[model samples]
Structures are given as C-alpha cells and as structure tokens.
Target: MFFFLSSLPELFVTVNRQPRGRICFSFLWVEGGRRGPCNPTAFAMEQLSTANTRFALDLFHTLNEKNPTGNIFISPISISSALAMVFLGTRGTTAAQVSKAFYFNTVEEIHSRFQSLNADINKRGAPYILKLANRLYGEKTYNFLPEFLASTQKMYGAELTSVDFQHASEDARKVINEWVKGQTEGKIPELLVTGVVDNMTKLVLVNAIYFKGNWQEKFMKEATADASFRLNKKDTKTVKMMYQKKKFPYGYIQDLKCRVLELPYQGEELSMVILLPDDIEDESTGLKKMEEQLTLEKLHEWTKRENLALIEVNVHLPRFKLEESYNLNSHLAHLGVEDLFNSKADLSGMSGARDLFISKIVHKSFVEVNEEGTEAAAATAGIATFCMLMPEENFRADHPFIFFIRHNPSTNILFLGRLSSP
Candidate 1:
C-alpha cells in the first residue's frame, strides 16, 4: 500500500505563486594558493556554499517532522556568505589549507559530502534548530547581530564580554538586507535600520522558512461568509470563512481519528497536505496526532499511493500574524560551535586573531492570508535569504488549516508555519 502511495505525482510550492524551480547565487574568493596568492575570500565562499546546502537539507527534515503543513524558504547564500567572513577570521588556516580541508571539485560535490553529516546534526539538534528557526523567522525579529547576541546571552544566562558583537561593514549590511528583502517578498521592514554595519562585524548568516497552500477542493469566494472565531479560552471575534464543495484527495483513518486532505503545488513536485482531527472541538488532540504520524518519509510514502480520491470539504482558516526573534549564539554554541564565539579561538583567515568574535545573529518573519491566496516572508541578516513561490489556487484559509511549501525535486522544505487564527 505504501509502495502504491509513492507513485502519486509530486508537487513543489512557494510563497510568490509561481512555478517551482531551484535558483542559487554565490560569490567565491581563493587567497594565498600554493601556485601563487590564493583568494582566502574565495575559499571561505566555497565553504559557505558547501555548508549551506547541507544545512538546507537538514533543516528540511527537521521542519518536516515538526509541522508538515506549510512552506519552507532557506537562504544558503546569506548564511554561507556571512559564515565565510567568520571562516576567514579563523586562525592557523590559509586559503589553500581551508580549501584542502573542505575539498570539493564543484559546489555540488561539497553538498553531497556534507549532506549526511548535516542529517546527523539535525537529528540530535532538532529542538534547538526548530526553536531558533521559528524565532528568527518571526516578524519584527531584530536585524543587528549585537542585539541578537545580547538577547541570547540573557536568555541562556551566558556571560558577556567586551569583544562580542563589534560592527559590520555598510556593504556587508546592504548585501544582507538585500537577501532579507528578497527572501521575504518585501514584507519585512527595517532589516538594517541603523548601527547594523561595521568592520569588526565582517559577516552575517541567515536562514528563512515559510509554508502555505490552498485546499485540494478550494472554497468559492461567494461561499465565504463572516463567521465568529474563538481565541484562547474566551475572546470571540468575527472572521471570514471560505466554503468549498468538491471531491478532494482525502482520507479518513480510524486509527488516527482524523480526515486528511492533500493540496498540490504548481509543478506537482510538492503538496501542502492538511490533517484535521475528527473532534474539531479538541484541536490539541488533532495537532498532537498529526505531529506523531506525519513524518517527511511517511508523507513521501503516503502521497505515492493512488488511493487518494476527491471528497467534499468545507475549509475555514483564519488570517493570522506571528512574530518571533532568536539569539543564535547559544544555539550555535550548543551545536558545538563554541570555538567561533570565543576570543581565544583562531580566526586569522578573516583578520588577525584576537580581533574577531561573533557579535550577533538576528532573524525575522511575517505572513498574511486573504481570500485570493497566502503571502509570507522571513529574513536573517548576519546574513541569510530563503524565498519560494508557486502557482495560485483558490485556497482561502478561512478556518484553521495546515500547509507546507516544499520542493518536489529534492523533497526539501524551505519554510513551515501554521495559520490557526486570523
């Protein structure tokens, strides 16, 4: 049965409502090569390119496990580029040495090499990464590294020193901001408002994820009518509910006591599937069951079967906005990246040792849903950019609905978020 499930057409979706495709931009510099002078910057760039691809795949699995109903966007360019600057600062390492340490004939080679290692890291570090990803992707997330550092220091009760979060260059800040805007579809504001650029802060790393989609059987706008929504335990508010009546790729499993719907993207490379509990009144149980049963691998297996058929569905999703921020220093430190945070650590590749230490890591995200479709964005500048778009649909999220933005070709998730209330 599972084997049959794997035969269904795959789909990929994005936030911009366009055809799904893979696009990447990168810059490299190799300093002080044995033949002559290798561009250290090039070596650092290569490292970022390699590391980010690995990170993206790992992140996809982590997010897929937690919330399989949404889109995901990741900016390897921003994260790798910023990390490259930090890599330059590492001590006892020449461009040639660094290049040799992370050997690769092509960018794809680097990705393949680190892919498995990143997966291991994700498995062990799921909680930390998910918390960080969610907070960083939240709307109103900070833009400066120092602010992020300070916040993180306080959160983790880490001791602060004078050497932390110096400053970044204007050029670096601009580049980071551009990546942020690009990833967020111009929704995030004031990414680098002020005091965000300086020389001491030479690099920034960022990653953004998002997910949204329409119903397999879309609700007609005419059917959409104002409905009262309950918030928390008490607050009741009126909201629009989109109604639809059509056959959908759906399933009702007694084991899980829920109904499932699959929403396909433009290329059929990915789909945003939703699992609603039988007891809609008890949202927690539904959410919990969905979380337990929905794994990335399982979804891939289930969607492969052709048993799914059209069924009637009345969809109601509320418009919602959630903003969160994170300080990644502690998170990275927890991930065994403590050396980079210490002044004693070598970073001569970027500049002289004792001259650099990570100053900050900031992230922000936003989302909006209307009768037409869904729009969302996320930004990380210290620095990062992750953006995606897919075909338009009649997916009016009037009631609580789950969605996922995914890549059909790679089965990679770029972003994942949920809209429970307007």
Candidate 2:
C-alpha cells in the first residue's frame, strides 16, 4: 500500500492491519501548514542530521572492525526510526542512555524532525519511488498506554496493530513479516524468523524503507566491461565494471587522502556519494581511518557547494549487488545502550507500568546497482574532509570504497555501504 498527497488539503490516511490479511483504512482531516524551505541554520532536522551522521560513522567503524574482509550495508534511518519509537516510551536513565547513544536530544525533537522530513520527501511530483513505513505490533492482551499510541501516530505516522502473539507466535511472525515485505516491495521478504518473536513478546517495532530511481545522467551500457577490482593491495578479481564520464559535483581532501563524487538521481532530491581512498589498501581499514578524521563540520567544509568543483571525471564503478541482515542488539549494547535490552530497561513511558523491554532488533537490507540506476530496500524491527588536487581526475573505483545514498534536502542518509570485492 502507498500514499499520494494531492492538492486536496488536510488528509490523514491510517491503515490498520490485523492478523491474516485484514486491513482497515481510516482518513482524518489534517490541517495544512505554511509551506516553505526548512532553514538549515535553525531547523532541528539539520542539527539531528549532523549528530546522526557522526553516530552513523561511528557505527560503521564498529561494524567494519567486526567484519574486516566482508561487505557492509545498513540504513541508519531505518534502524533509528524503529528505535525512535521505542525511545518515545523511555524515562530517566534509560531515556538518557538511548538519547545519547542514538544522537537524539529529546523525544519531541526526534518525533518532530522525523515528521518534517517525512512530509518533505512524500511531496507530490517526485520522479522516483521512496516509501517509508512504521508499525507497532502489540500482543492482544498487552495494555499499551493511549498517549504512547497517539504520539506515534501524530509524530511518526505509525499505527498500532493487535496481534495474537500470546498464543500463536509463529502466526504473529508471519503477519509482521508480510507487512514488512509489502512495505519494501518484497526486497526484504523475511525480516523476522521463528525465535525472534515469542509468546512472551509484548511489543515489536518495525520500519521499512524502499527506494528505486534512475540516474540523472545515465551511463552507457556498451561502456560497461569486465575489469579487475583489487580486493587488497595484492589480490584482485575480474568483475563487471560500469563506466561513466561526466562532470559531477566533486571534491578532494588532502588530509584524508580521498576523492568525493556526488551522482544525483533523476529527481535530484537524492544522490549517491562515493569516497575513494588514494592508496590501494584494505577498504575497511582505509574507511575506518578516514572515518576517524571525519567531523560534521569538516564534512560540511569539504562537500559544501562552494567547495566542490564540477570537473569531468572518468568514473569506472563495478556493477554489484548486496543483501545482508544483522541483529543489532549486541551492537547497541556495545554502544552504551546497555539498559534497554536487559532487566534494567525502563520503558515505563510505553506502557503505564515498567513492563516493556526490547526483545530483538532485526534489520535486513538489499541494494543493486547497474548501468541504469539503483534499487535498494531496508527494514529494521525494534531495533570527511580533504584538500588536494593534482594530476588525473580519474575516479577508477578498482579498489574498495565507501558509498552513501542520501536525501539531498535533509542530508539524511538512507543507505550506507562498502564495496569490498564487488
């Protein structure tokens, strides 16, 4: 199911689904507001985006340390959306821990910023398909607070659904998975498995994001050829390499020793930025080193419109596909969110009593890049600088590199990945 915002004023679409294929739709009149550009200097979304970027980089480094030789793909927005809903119902130390770890200042700030961003992206006339969905599934007998449900719908556009997890956990799993699958256009079919949700589970928060778009400047299919992509300084493998030479918004940083390139999508609202290290080193380690020196201030100084030069670049990027799933419980625990998963978790704000704690955070992502464009989807359940210049401006991504699909207006990263061998 999708949403369309037309010229008609004040419309709220609420879709509630029960166990099995039962779906009920309700529409409410929502008053419209003054439409204007969100000022970057004062808006909470910009500040949140900056803080979230740092957190995303930190998480990327953590994941990189764990899997040195493998590929990495994740959606911070997806995971954060799920956890943000959980954050709405936290208090005291639990809330403080999660707020600091997730880069959220307050529950209201998180909710408002997300609501504004969602409204901006969901506007009509967008040339691509970008869908974001959130759902809260509670056991039939669990008495979730009314304020919690109202806040989720008002701020995050999420709806609560009652499922029979108390008696049939397997069936509840299927119901949630089917909703996730529909949200991601089947790119993420199975997000929850047998043991993830059980009879004891009181609540499960899930978020899914899907994006598909063609390139603003399409690459020629005939130019794509087999080329050797260096896995490391010593190892190499031949892969299908896509070639495109165009004048893109590009920049260089001497301190970090990397080149930045931004390739816009058809709508120009979102784009893919790639960072290629100057040396042919392990991309994971290279990425970690670069990430260490990265600050939001320095990133702004580098990628700022006045800083980048639209130089013609010979780009040779390998065509690749990646689909990966991760259980973020341990990762969040390691990152100082230790209270939420254990007995110390204080989720009293979700329910009147202190009875709710996060059970599992299941995240899965899929991405495909070819000559035409990109198709990527991600689902989450409860979860750089430089200066430089010089010789040839050829960005031959024959080695490992980092890439991000970000919304240009809000500067929110929808997807982040590393192409190690692909």
Candidate 3:
C-alpha cells in the first residue's frame, strides 16, 4: 500500500504489492546459449543461500546498531555484486575473507548464482519493473587481463569500460554517474562526487538496482489521513497514514515480540515484509531486541506457511519516503573485509600485476511508500571502495519499524530499510 525508494552513490541520493504465494530455490541457468531449469538444492547452492542469509542478518544487526535513532536503507544485493566483482580479482586470504564475509562459495558458484537469479527475476513478465545493472570503469591505461573481463561478462553480465581516471577524473565521474542515472531511470543522479575519483584511482565498480511494483490489493487513496506517528514515548509527529483492511499473510513471533505481515505485489513473485514491534512507547528498544534474536533460521521459520495465518487485519501504515547515503569503508572493515581496502590488498585478478586496491565504497538509497505501491532505487560505486520479514494481523506501523522487499522465489532480500521518523 505504499511506495519504497532507495539509492547508493558516494554522496548521491534518489529516488511493491501482491498476494497468493510463491516458493523458493528453483532457478534458471543459461548454457549452450539456451536457458534451462536448475534446482537450488545442491550442496553448494544451499551453502551459498544459507551464507548469504546469515550475512544479511549479520550486516543488518550492524546497521541497526550503528544507526539506532535514525532511519536506514541498504541494498545488500547491489553491494554484494560490487564486492563480488572485486572478489573475482582477489587471491589467497583476501578472496577467502570476502567469500566468508559475504557467504559466497567459489568464485564460479557466486557468478553462476547471480547470473541465474538476475535472469529469473528480470524475466518474470509480471506487473513490475525490476532491474539490477553493473559496470566497471577502469583507468584507460590499466592492463586488465582478458580472463577477468570474460568472467565478468559471462557471469556478472558486466562489461569493463576504459575511463581516463589519471586525468579528467571529474569527466570520468560524470560519465559514470550518467550511466548510473540512465540505468536507474534518473532515480540516482549523482553516484560519484568530484573527489571520489582522482588521479590515484584505478578501477571503479558500480552496481544499481531499481524496482517498482503495484500492490495486488491496493490501498484506497481516500483512506489516507493525517495521523500521529509516535517517534518515541515523549515525542510525536503528524504523518499521512494509509489504511487497508483485508485478508493477509500474518504471524506473530512470540520470541521476538513483534508482528510480521507480508504484503504481496501484483505478480505474487515478490513481497514487502514488515516487522512491527509490539511496544511503541520506546520504538528503539523493540527493534534492538529483535536485532538480538534475528537470524536466517528464525526469519525462515517465522514466515513459513504454517506460521502465517490468513486473517482479516486492519493495517495502518504511514505514507513515508526515505533517502539515505552511507560511506561503508569503516563499516565493511568492521565486518572482516579489511584487506581489500588497504595497500596490502591483492587484486591481481583484474590486472596481471597486483597494482589495484579498493579506495572506497560509497552507497546511497531511496524508498517511497504510498497508497499505490512501492518505488525504490539504490546505487553502489566501489570507487574501488568496496564495501527482513514478518506477517500479519492488525499491523499498525505507527512507530519505528524494519522492512524489506524480497524476491520470493530466491528468498533474496533486495532492499532493507528502517522507518524511524516516518
């Protein structure tokens, strides 16, 4: 019943619904220039899936703890793809650390899964527009190996382009930003700032995702009204609240003490799952507690078919929008991704010589939720910087809460956000 927006640029800023149901783990692969069905039940696939979920949960806890009082929004997929590209060039412990931190299996496995997932999501042919794009802008003089470029094009669908970063860095930045803007439908205009790319810059890896979807059971525009949103026990602000009452997939996690509601988009291939805490007096406390117990297993169990009961519920969700930007260098270092950013980094896979290292990873996100649907955009520029759920019944998101837009088939969390003020 609302719009969601997200974006991630160095200092850049910018810019779903359904029902029925969908299952997960069935993917499609392209081989011999033909598409074929592939099951996500293999050992490697399971390992990657579990690892990615765990990584998402771990990163979420960090973000939740880092910005306890403010709103937060991030595109893990975009960040992951950006880093995955860098990981392809890493060796020894550098690659191992990234693989461990991000829950990627082998480099081969990582690219293949992303390839299949990207293809499946984009080809759903549903009433939604979802796009994930990647680009690599390296210094025109850098000798990038052919093998690296081939792997990127085959697995990640990314083409490495030569950009003159040694001189005219600003122009290079502008070109990259323009490409990002075009990929994201102008939702994210400025991804890299003036100083983000300088003479010392070697390679810049970028990833962008844009999604727009309509609700299966759209909220009536006439039902929106000005309502008091509880910022905290002692503070309040007026917000435009959207109302909808209908049968929805709903669950209450007793252990976490929160309500979980799943609002499906038109095609039922994706959904926005909201976790509204039980107590609104102190919004931060409930969210903090949930973070303590949040895990991949718990998320899966809580949203399982048996746990969510169909019920006629009254929903009061605010018509809110958020645009957030983050510099993830320190945050990622704290998450065991240290080697890639420092001089000791080994990124020889991109070039035959080990002369490349990540300088910074800048991200920005935007989300808008309204009576119609959700619109979200996120851009991540590795300026060589490298960088969940619930169900329903009487969900009243009048205070701070956490939300995510997920691909139901792959169980991939595309965009995650926190609504603090709105």
Candidate 4:
C-alpha cells in the first residue's frame, strides 16, 4: 500500500506526458456573428487543451533521463489558457459572442483527471497541486491590446506614431510583458526580450510556466564542498558541489546499452534520477540509446515492485544557469497547426473580417540549481506558427550528474536540467 501511494504521482505525470491523439471535433460549437461563421471560442479552448497536454508530456520526457534527480511543479491550465486567448485575438461583440459560444467539457475532464492525480500524491504527503485555470473564464485581456497600444504611444518620450495590430511593435511588446507579469506570479522575466512583438503582429500567444518543490531527501549544507567538475574531455574546473549519502530506493537497469538509475523522491510520489551510458567512450551512441528508451511506459514498469538498498554514494553537483531562445513557427507548422499561420485560416470570431494570422513563435527557458534546490522558468509565444527544425545534437551531458523536476503519480515533468559544477 505504501509503495502504491508513492508511485501514484509518477503515474499521473506519465499519463499527462503521453502524446495525445487528434482532438475530437465533436466538442466544438459554431454560432452566427458579424465575422461570418466564426468559432474562435471553440478553437481557443481546443488549442489550449492540445498545447497543455503536449507541454506536460515534453517536460516529463526531458526531465526523466539518466544521471539526475529532482522535483517539478506547474500550473498547466493557466499557461495553456493564456496562450489560447492570445491566439484567438477576439474583440468587441465578436469577442463577447465567442466567449459565450465556447464550452469547456474537455477542460473539465482534464481537471478531473488532474484532481485524481493530485489526490494520490496528497496521500503520499506531496504538496497540493493547484492549476488556477479559472483565469481563462474571467475577463479577456487581448481585446484591450489596441487601447493598451494607444496608451503606450502617449507615454513614450519619442514621437513614435505607428500603431497597428498586424505587426507587433515595441508598444506591443510592452503590453505583453505587463500581461505576463500579472499572470505568472512574477516567475518569468523579460518575456519579449528580443523585440519580437510589432505592429504587423496580427496575433500574439504567450504561456508562462513555473515549477517549485522541496526535495524528498534534503541535502545537508555541511556535506557540500568544493570539487572538480569536467565540462568536457579537455576542460576541467573546480567548483562547489553538494554531496549526500543515504539509504535510498534506487534502481539500475540497462536499456539499449545505457544504464538508467531511478532515484525516488520523498513520499515516493516523484523522483529525480539520471541515465548514463556504461561506455562513456561512445557518448553519441549512449545518448541515442537513452532517448530511445526514455518513455513513461518503461519507467512505470521499472519502478513497479523495485528493490530497495542502503548504498554509500558520493553525489556532487554544481549551481548553474541556462537560458535558451527558440523560434517555433517552423515547429508548429510541422505539428499540423499550419492553418492558424495563414490568411485563409479563419479567426473571424476574434474580430469581424479580421485578416489575422500568426507570424512567429518564440520560446525561452531558464534554470538554476544550487545547494537548496532548483528554479526554472519557460515561456512560449506564437504570432504565426511557422516551421524551423533545428538539428538534434547527441545528448551527451557527461558532467557530474543531472536532475529532473517531476510529479510522481502522473510522471509529468515540470522541468529537466543538469548541474555540471557548483
């Protein structure tokens, strides 16, 4: 019974992380309006559902690799709903009508699923997970983007006079930052850091995701000390690394030539574990094997009825920061969401006869790890979903160790990162 409750969070996270099937169209409802035949509300809701599921799944998969262990928490509904509204771009009567027309049976179902998952985690004494999804049903914000832009012009010291919704401008960027700060509990920083918003910006969608949790087995500060860290084969540096030795629920398994380790978190609801190849000589093959075998199904099977042991192990990890920015227009296009990026795509429910289409998609993520724990922030923006496929590099994070922010029952990953040195 103890093990069953402990494994629940991973189960929930895993289920949430699984790639979803095509959305069922039966839930959408269309109504007559000045925009001709528009269903922006339905479209927005559907998109939110799909994005939330995908984000939850991707986060888990990335975090639950070999070599690290940690915690992850998030408000998936909040981030997904915010992104959906920005994409819809509804205004005035059309906005109000579309809001009324949109129904959320699917959202309710997801809430129910999360609630059940949370209950299992709570049984294991994990922090209560709160989604805060009601913001979506509240008053809309993007409808006022025009007014917000006008105010920006008046406040600007310069005589910048151009203000159009089709192209996102500096003024547009300011509006988005203000909105994001209000929604994300001030977790995200500089949302539009690259001046990606402008007047030609017909639609702007933003999602801010945050995760915070306590470690199951907290590391003692006295155990932390300076150590040597290898950045690569030729470069080695000395840095502070935290160390801990305890009896832990650990697993060692070989999947396609890589040794995967499972480190259970407190309450056994979640875990922070890592996978490293036995043959570090062939780093490329090791990373490929790890990725191929990294899935919720295999993880679930592995953790079920596992062996427990008290092992004397020295763990050293550094405090590090990572920030990355990506343009996701190309990624979304590859994902079959191309219509929202084209003129032919109908977003009439947002505004009457508005020739609106997404022009860009941007993503930024940051992570910090120290003796205390881990902190991370990520944001995704879609103006017009285009296509950009970056080359995949070998996942050779052959440093000290890696950590993952994960929910135990669902195995949903909030974040995944590595700590090379202190």
Candidate 5:
C-alpha cells in the first residue's frame, strides 16, 4: 500500500508502491546487495550506473541479434535489482558470474552502492513519479538462511513473504502478478504465467518499477501528421510523426554520422536522448553504424555537457508505444552466468545446501510517447529559408534510431531502446 520506502534518512523500509500517474513499465521475475556512503563516483552509484549501462548495451546487442528487425525495450536496472535480491542468497560461481556480468568488482560495491543510489532515487515528492518495488515469495515449507533474509530486507528494502508455492501455485502466481501489475500501473499485466511456478517451486523473486513524466517542451498535435517511415531500404509504413521546433541540447558523432538530441522531460529532471543516424545508401543499415560505435564511454562522450550545444532544432519523432518481454535464460547463460540454471550450480547461501538454483529470468517493460505526458500542448513550427538569421538543425527520425531515457541528476539511464519501425 502507501509505504514510505527508503528516501529520507529517517526511514529504511523496502520500496513503497508510491502510485501516481500514467505508465511506463519495469517488472522482473528472477527464479534466482550491503551498505556504504552515498558516493556518486567510480566507487559508488556511478559504478552501478556504469555497470547498468554496460549490461544494458550487452543485452541490447544480444536482443538485436535475436530480433534484428524488431523494436526492443527493457529495464536493466529492474532486472539487476531483482537479481540483487537473489544475489543476497547466492554463493560461489553463481555470485561470480553475476558480478562479472554486471561488471561490479565485489559484493560491497554492488550492494552498498545500490543501496545508496536507491535511497537517493526514491526521494519523496520527486518532480516525476517513480515506483520501484521488490519482493521474495518462498514456499512456506522452504528453509532459507536468516542472514540472507535479513541482509536483503535491510539493504534492498525487500521482504520475504511466505506463500504456498508448493500447494497453491496458481494462487501464488496471481498474487505476485497482481503486485507487479499494481506497481507498474498495469503497464505490465502479468509477471508469472501458469507454468512458471508449481509444486516444486521453492522461491520466486519479483521486482517492478514505474515512471511517467511530461516533456519539458511539448510536441504539438497540430504539427503531427501521417508520414512514411522507412523500416529498412525496402519496407515502409505510415506513422504519426510528432513535430516540435525548440532550442535543445544536441550533439553529433562524426565517426558514425549520428545526431544526438536530448528532449527533456517536464522540470528538466530527466531527458530522452535520441541517436538518429544519417541516411546512407542502405538506409536499413544506417543504425548499424551507430550501434557499431556504441559504448558506455562513447555514449557518455557524445552526450557530455561540453559536447552538446543548445540549438534550435526541428524535431520529427514518430509517436510510438513499446511493450516487450524477454525470457532471459539463454541470454544469461551465453553472457557467462552459466551455473545459475543448470545442475552444476551452487546457491548454498540460501539454505546451507546447493539444492536451490535459478530456473528462469523474465523481464517486461512498457513505454509510450505522444504530444506530452497525458495532455496535449499546442505549438506552431517556424519556417524560414536562409540561416543568416539563426542556424537550425533538423532531427528527423523518419527511419530507425536509438534512444535512451536518463535520470539527469544521477546521469543514470532509466530506459534504452530503438524505434526501428515506429
């Protein structure tokens, strides 16, 4: 219900479902953190952000290979947070692979920094509404370690609830799914399907986060019209192209020939940065050039404070909504988290026995962009021939492009995906 999760130094209860507005998804299921200062450097939250970005890109590359011509979306932080809850109960190679995959050096950095940053983000009355939650549902008969339970509860604000996973699998699934749906504002309807948990299910880990914010500068409806989007060199589709002409932060990468533009959310607390590549002979492969040069370092360099200049830009972005789910089993195994799912695993920290291991990882996320947040604002586009007055740039996403939503204050990426067909 209305729990005042860890924000003000006065409290330390796990995340509260601070329900507010419209939806953007972040729900996770893991069949699978400590404490330190609130430092934001390579030692603390910054490292976690770095790890999150690194894993985000890695996962993006994997998803791209799997669905080369489809739109993909995910919340790495949501997945990582859910995994962190499970990380509390991991040992040996299980923890090693997780550490390596996330790029965190040690247990201290992962849990301590995660705890610090989580508190900073969960600050109450924030400009935008954000709800992140995690819970552990274990079979009432299962025997988990007291230390693991206490650590997760204190550091991650997660609580382990007793559920009849052995006898009432469907009921347990519904309860977990309902919690996820509520936390995600219904953007994610269900997190656990019929076959995910059953009589032998001993534990289920879940996490969900929701975010909704209005644009600092509105894209007027009158400026929007049906425009042809080049899905690739061959296919094309009609899309609602939202338009806006405003002075915003913009950058360009000479090597990749991609333009980066930041469309800030209301109050400028968060911004959506778009990476639109210049149309080449093979328009379909334009994004590949950008992706080839894409890295956490390059991304930071391209969007850094000094690299971007505020200029008047004519923005033509397609109105799009994306809801995606991933079964991350094969993906993680390929990423070096091998032992977590198979018989050669070790999760003894959970119960002083190696009997427990993760069976699957399910991730779901959703997002929608339009004229504004929930209401439409009107603006007229400026038209002029010669740039003798003022130079202007054009950011036309009539084709595929990559985008990321960043929490400005922390510089932590909230969401990352590409609109290939939108």
Candidate 6:
C-alpha cells in the first residue's frame, strides 16, 4: 500500500491482494517507460526491472537496518509503480528526486516504456491472479492540466473521477476507501483513514493490485514438522518446517558463502529466490556478511541464469507470514528525495502551477507462506540430502535468510523480504 494523502493539491494511494489468502495493502495518497542505456542490448523492461530491483534492495537494506530482528514483507512492484505514477504529474526538482530515488534516470523514455512494462506485467490469462490497477480522483472544483491528466491516463491507465473533497472530505474518504476495498475484494476496508482527506484535498490517484504465490514444487504438509529456527547463535524458535526435495535451479556463491535456490510458482513465470548462508556456531554470523555484499552488480552476477544450474535439493523452509507498514517520507529524505513531500516541491506538471506537493507516503503490506501451493502439489508429495565435496544440494533455512519474488521474464522483483526471527 502506497498512500498519497497530501495537504496539497491532490491525494494518491493504492492497495494489493493476492489469491487464496490475499495480500492486503492500501495507499491513501495517490501514485516507467524506458529502455536504459549502459546495456544497449537489453530491452526496456529489462532495464526498468534492473532499476526496480536495485531500488528494492536499497529499500530492503534501509528497512532491515532500521529493524534488524523483525520479519519484513513489502511489494516492491506496488511501491515502485505507485511512486512512478505520482512522479508522472511532476516536473523539475520533484521529478529529479523521484527519478534519482528509483534510478529511473538511467532509463530512456521512462514513462512510455514503463507503460509497456506495467501492461505486460498485468496481462490476463496467467495461471494465477496477479494484476495492477490504476485510477485517478480529483476535487470537483480543482482544475488540472489536460496534459497531466492525459499523460497519467495514457501511461498508467488511470481514469479521473471527480470527487468533492473540499466540501465532503469525510464522504470522499469513505468513497475512495470503499472503492479500494472493492478493488481488493474487501481485503482492505479502510484504505483512507479518517483524517487523511480534508478540506485542503484537491485530487487523488489510487491503484490496486492482486497477486498469488503458488509453488511449482510445493512443500509437503505430511513431511512438515516442528523444527528449531535459530534467531542467532544464542536463541532459537520452534517453527513448522516445510520439507521438499526436487531438482531446481540452484547455485553457490563462493564469495558470500551462500546457496541460492529458485522456487518457481505454478506457471514458472514468477519465482521466489532464497539466499541461505552457512550457519556459524559462534558469534553473529547472521545475514550481515550476505547483506554487505548485496549490490545490484553483485546480485545480477549471483542470480543470472548462466550462474545457476538445475540440481536436486533438500529444501527445508519455515512457513511464515509477515505484515509491514512504513511511512516513506523519512526514508525518501534519506535517499535525497525530500522535495516531493515538503513545501519546496514543484509539481507544476499536475496543475500547471506550484500548488501541489506530496505531504505523506504510507505503505502497508501483507503476505503468507504455507504448505499449500498449486493444485499439482497435492498429487506429488516429493519428500527427502546431500554430501560434501560434490555439488552442494542441501538447502537448510534454519536461520535468517533473504528472499525475493521475481518476475522471470523481465527480471523485476515483485516482493523483497527476509525471515529474521521466523
């Protein structure tokens, strides 16, 4: 959820949910086309995906550093897409900051190519339901530039709906929230909190999305049993360990001394990649070493297709769920993106004047992992180990590990998080 409730020209927001058990999130405030250079051979989606993933890792590091020992789950696609929409209606420093914050500047013709990328990501007929939605709202009296409106609508597929925020802020909030709730299939009933919309509100932009995580080779519930998950060298917690053994794309990064496992979803178009480090008995040999080397270049080198090989693996994963919310104003400021949220902002692209600025940005996310997966999992409960010297195939996530959901084709990361204490 990325909420854009500003005390300025307009409000922007969005929500996300997945299938079966859904991911519920809403942004009360509102919300890339581009091929990047540097790698001229790459497609626009590839370049944008690189930028998105780079931002995802940066945001993950920031959040993890803020709360090192807690569970984290956020939709990088949701946040990045939402912010890109908002930045669509901005120019000058406001645009520069947003571009810099997300590394969109590296991409050429970012808005148009981003539209293509977003549209491709949301295409129907996938094995599971995962979609990104966009819409716009404005105060009945406020006048917005046709250029901004047309650009946002064409680029993000957002259709503007006029609401009387000046006279009926409460009613407007309820309407917007209900719309978001309906869009999320009632997953988020209250997207716009009471005080988020008031007399000063002039416009709003909202987005919604749905996602599903169905494993291509799911864990067996029968094989799953309570196991000890080490919080660190000194502390451990009991967790239901999901067990599975099958051939998957696996790799070993000697530099970080970690094993990477790619677990595809039902369609094989999306996957969850896990990074598990060797456990150390003494000292805090946690994810610090792994995190230290997590640069975009290194990540690309580590996860590239050529670097991995299909191999049989004994996978032991903990079934966990996480919900995280963050006010991105401070974090964006730390990234030198403070203009959009403060009075010094310039968003003349939206209203043809300098009356608009993003006041607040709140993001909330939820996700769960269990033994359940695609319908095929029930039929084959493949349950099972590895020896040293040969190719390593035993993957044990008994301690803290890093994982991210990735769109296979474009290499865009959908979600990035870690199980610190789970």
* Range of the 10 consecutive residues with the lowest summed lDDT in candidate 2: 1-10
Per-residue lDDT of candidate 5, residues 102-192 (tens digit): 7765334578767766676567876677655666676797677899878877787778888886678789878876876666566555555
lDDT of 4 by residue, 16-45 (tens): 001210000000000111122375544443
Cα-based lDDT for every prediction: 0.36, 0.66, 0.66, 0.36, 0.64, 0.67
Ranking by lDDT: 6, 2, 3, 5, 4, 1
lDDT of 1 by residue, 1-422 (tens): 00000000001100000121111111110011222246544454344333443443343345445444433233222233223323333444333333332232234334332332223222432211111111111111112245444432333221222212233245444554464444344444335545543432322333333233343334467877777754323444688665654545655444555455665543343345564555434433225455555543444344432434454444555544554333334533443355444344444432233444444444334444455444444301111111121121233333343454443333333334444455
lDDT of 4 at 279: 45
CA deviation > 4 Å runs, candidate 1? 1-108, 112-185, 204-219, 230-236, 280-286, 292-307, 310-312, 321-324, 331-337, 344-355, 379-402
**lDDT value, residue 255 of candidate 4:** 33
The lowest-lDDT stretch of 10 consecutive residues in candidate 1 is: 1-10
Error of 2 at 154 (Å): 1.2
Which residue ranges in model 4 land beyond 4 Å of their true spot?
A: 1-172, 178-187, 200-205, 231-237, 256-270, 283-286, 302-313, 348-354, 379-403, 417-422
lDDT of 6 by residue, 1-422 (tens): 13632100012442211111111113321002234666453565666777888888888778877777677666666677777777776688878988998988977777886687668767888886566676776778767798888988899888888878667879987988777666555555566678766766766677665566578887878999999999888889999999998988888776567888888888888877888887743355388877777878777667666667888888999988765567777777787787766556677777667755666667666556788751100001111012122454789999988887777777877667777876
In model 2, the Cα lDDT at residue 386 comes to 43
| Backbone clash numbers for all candidates listed | 89, 4, 45, 57, 2, 21
Per-residue C-alpha lDDT of model 3 across residues 194-232, encoded as one tens digit per residue: 665566556666666778889878999999999998887
Residue 48 displacement (Å), model 6:
1.0
Q: What are the TM-scores, per candidate, against the unseen true structure?
A: 0.51, 0.85, 0.85, 0.55, 0.85, 0.85
**lDDT for 132 (candidate 3):** 71
TM-score of 6: 0.85
- Measured on C-alpha atoms, candidate 5 has an lDDT of 0.64
Give the poorly placed runs of model 2, Cα more than 4 Å off.
1-42, 106-108, 281-288, 379-392
